[model samples]
Target: MVLDKFNSVRMLNTDALQADFVIVGGGISGVCAAITAARQGLKVVLIQDRPVLGGNGSSEIRLWMLGATSHMGNNNRWAREGGVIDEIMVENTFRNPEGNPIIFDSVMLDKVVSEPNITLLLNTCVYEVKKSAGHKIESVRGFCSQNSTMYEVTAPLFCDASGDGVVGFLAGAPYRMGAESREEFGEKFAPAEDYGELLGHSLYFYTKDTGQPVKYVAPSYAMDVTKTVPRFRSFNAKEHGCKLWWVEYGGDLDTVHDTEQIKWELWKVIYGAWDYIKNSGKYPEAETMTLEWVGCIPGKRESRRFEGDYMLIQQDVIEQRHHEDAVSYGGWSIDLHPAAGVFGEESACNQWHSKGVYQIPYRCLYSRGIENLFFAGRIISVSHVAFGSTRVMATSAHSAQAVAVAAAMCLEENISPREVYSLGKVSELQKRLSRMGQYIPDMKIRDEENLVKKATLAASSEYHFKGFPADGEMQALDESVAQMIPLHKGDRLGKVKVGLFVSEETLLEVELRVSSKPFNHTPDVTLETKTVSLCQGKQQLELTFEAVMPEEQYVFLVFKKNPLVQLQYTKERITGVLSVFNTINEAVSNFGKQTPKEDIGIEEFEFWCPKRRPGGHNIAVQSEKDCYVFSVSNIDNGIDRPVQSPNAWVAELNDPAPALTVRWDSAVRIGKMSLFFDTDYDQPMETVQMTHPENQMPFCVEKYKIYDGEGRLVYEKTDNHQSINEFVFPEKLVTDEIKIVLEHPSDLIPAALFAVKCYE
Candidate 1:
């Protein structure tokens, strides 16, 4: 790929580009605005200064993307649809394998990237926006870092998504900073009089597991925090020490204007805390852990808010007043951190309101002067008292969505934002958002009964239950006991049912079972299969599985299996299955491995099983290169090893050219496995079962198979390819052992191998 010249100033001809809307900031709000406009078929240019898309929640800062619904105790309500936010979530799920940092960023990114009409320019900063005499933005001038060029971008509409309202400020848009007197907005929490004091900023950090001891050394300029503070406000005085408390150091510094000083102080405090930790030796096992994050950029809690058509106030928030122009809701309390100049405990306040939630008006999101300009995020027009509640990330995200929709409306009508509002286009905007899966509960037009019915049907269709009754009954029915049963999908109704088990206690014990077919297996893969049983006032069950190779094959588990209950297999990847269910049910499983298959060049394989108790069983198989052992057992521990192979193999070179092992145990049941050759690498390999005589253990084998690009089998073992050992073994086996090899015809690389398992 040819690289573009860096730092070379150049400007593209204006005739080559066209966009109906331009969104500055590239933060959550900007990205959402671009997505919403693009989805409406309006071309949009989204300019972000940072390389990464998310602003505060980006990996660089690592701030959590809190939404309005989040503070309201319903996190799902934020970013309800797969817009820019949802895309970020999906991407984060893939990028950040260990944690959900990237998930948050990717959710926002996905929306921007997936939109056909959105043009994203990262590493670009908009320094100036030119407006017409009528107070309408005509174009924006941004400097691109990659090309070192400044370009003038023109669009019919402009949006200010910068958390600080940088674009609005440059465009001479009216905006306010700091507190408004309580009298101005009738806000209960506002100060009696106006003041410039604002909430201080913070430098957040995160840590992970550390196996070894860690030590911290105080910085040279570290202050004696203990001497300068009042008595500690302990959450749990008896059990916890106030180490984290020492890290707090901000007081009297303007969060926005004096950010540099604030950052320096925070750094000193951090180093001091680390020093205290090391000297105190309280965290001995924290050596291997990482700081993960440090004070890179200070998170400003308060800044300049662009003045819009209407300013949302604390009165509206406390009263939960429903406004005709309301676009979003906030449930977080009026949590006003101490303004600059307060010290120690006096610097913070945590007063919270009861069940009530605040409704934010739409009029507070667009510019009061700039006709085509709109604002979202923390900069939305809200009084200090109301800003306390709406300032949370969740509320900001909802505000983004509202502004995006309003922008789209403006683009469609080719009118100013104020005109859109005056024409009562906000209701249509809300309706459009609702159709896109945004959770605007107030705008829901569907009846409660219809919504409930749809939800009920979806729940029933996707629900799956597995386990055995403790009483040894095949069937059990107890709504109360069954209430504990788990579902694979959807939110838990907090109601479950168990059939065939009965107990005097209100909560009955039951064991759940789950199983899955191999990914490359024949026919359609059975994602999960399990049987639950309840016994001895407790639940106990055993799951046994085996690989019956009809051809050269590959197989693996794709379901729950983890002792920590933190791991599970998706269709194409492994992930933590942690969700709302874990909190309610204390059940966990173990990780299991993929199934193994081999070439037999034979018609069939079988073995004899000696009957024993209905519990664990062990099976052994020997190949020309190794001996494989598998053990299947039933335990009441609820921990299933889903990712681990039940069988093990040690290769021995003197056996037959194509080795085969078959075993039978009541504890094990045969599932599916496949084999692939180089020719079928880009196609689906086929499965063919050869006839075999019945025995204590019954199974079949095939000679050859073909594979495809998607790991699917295309051609089955036929009479022409009757020999399993048709291919020559390489002179030197790269590894010491021989395992299942899947050859991709499209590539020169050798086949992939997997472990083998059989029924116990």
Candidate 2:
């Protein structure tokens, strides 16, 4: 088109988009938030600054995702995070077992892009937040440099999944940066002196074997080859992304504003560190290895945190306090790193584990000042000390899912997030979240839509001779392993059943110990040790302990090593058990190690309490109210986690051709039904999980068949790979009774299943 030749100049195009929810950030939290909200039937716009999904876990940063289930993998039996992140882990495990960072990135993008209700905008950074009246956020503006467009997105609600909490920042929301003083939040883990310092950013590098000797040249801008930075002993050719987690910086300065400078320093650090490893002759094994990739963008650990309705603190975590509105559980230790970062001298940070799983309330997820604003990820309302545990990505993702569901409830009810909390609608929110596969510690499901809730059990599943299924295959626990056994006021303990192996004549000292701090989940206080000698071979031995019991105290059973004697260990990684090392020669220590060298939660080694002849327990198909025996029967307990003992159901191991039937009260129109099968709750589904038994996961219905009333065959499935199996019928089936004929997956072990529900 011919226009007047008026001074032509480049124009800035501003595009406006409207959605029900505007989520800023593409981190796991943001991804989960968007997915959860979108799945709940809300139009969502997810703006992420990076080209790819996964904030820290992306190929750019490559920080491994560790969450409420601490990486150490001890006493975290069922602490694996579920929700949206669980789906990612399962898919990633199946698709990218080698743990390729790029594949993981693709996995995240596929999930985000596949959601029909989600408009995922990658490489778009949301910088400005527009707030309307009454503490409400009207919209946010993001600049996408790739398309050279500025998007002004308006929504009824906003979520700051941005790790930096930028949306909340611009919305004038009350937020806290850096560490609060000890007196500010009464946090015991807070620094003795007040400081506006936060955890630092980290840089990492990957190396690959070239198969031939490769020479390296150091960049001129690289730091000193060996002088400025330390850690000579830890730096090895084998160590890569996660092993070098301590390569951090930029905590002393402003992490957000001074990002470029930090990035520069990190780049130089990686080069110089690699130079030292290759040229300085420190690592001899580097001769054939070459640097494959180096990260330019630093992974941030701490930044601006929004002030929400409640500030989670140290007392809540250590005391294992139960919240009425507890929406998520955090089992990770209080891991607070110093600001000195890579230049620091001592170990990374001060880590303190919780005695048991702690609760994260819904109150801390929404803005206190910004009425329509909600937050997830590391930016949730928590003191720096409390943030130590909640900052992990998995925990943050759980928080994201919680807020997203809450946001849906808000949108449906036409109320603010604050109203959801003030009106005591948290219970309803918790019920909804649990129904969606979120684990709320003390919550129970009461959904009227759960058709299984009304069904009466008319089945064949043998009762008695039932107990918690054993995680197949156990090895000798040569290391120090202990469990945080709960003791009542009158409980007595004298002996424990242990699988012991001896290579030569040796003795092992067994003892019971308690955590040094009454609240800490560590076994540093030794009560006593009993020594027993053994000969060469494996034996089921009964280790005796003095009848020394304390009132309502958390204690650990300590086993000392004799080199020749090794106790049998199962990789189950059971909850309530802890592994203690380095305590043998230390005067004072924080348990053995918070997450010393493991990526999974602490290992559940084999050490059993001596019992009289295994009287065992029973699992009967009772009323639907009490479905899974040995498990608390309720709507709240879904397969998100295996409820420790008997997942509340009988395995038809000893029965002949078992068939469990659900007789409904009346004809219920059902087109889709969901069956939650047990997938070895004792093991973990998280990427951090280590076990991979050859057989199918415990209680997984490898093969099953379904039938309607009148014994009409309706459905049959074989070799199912997923835990949550869903069946959608082309035409809705109006039936009063539905039956499942269980074909035991194993002849020795019962084919155990969890929950069965129908959706209309």
Name the top lDDT candidate: 2
TM-score of each: 0.55, 0.83
List the RMSD of every prediction in angstroms: 20.1, 6.7
Q: What lDDT score belongs to each candidate, Candidate 1 first? A: 0.45, 0.69
Q: Write the per-residue lDDT of candidate 1 for residues 54-79, one digit (tens) a residue.
A: 67666655555544323112111112
- Error in Å for residue 480 of model 1: 19
Q: Which lDDT value does model 1 have at 748?
A: 14
Best by TM-score: 2
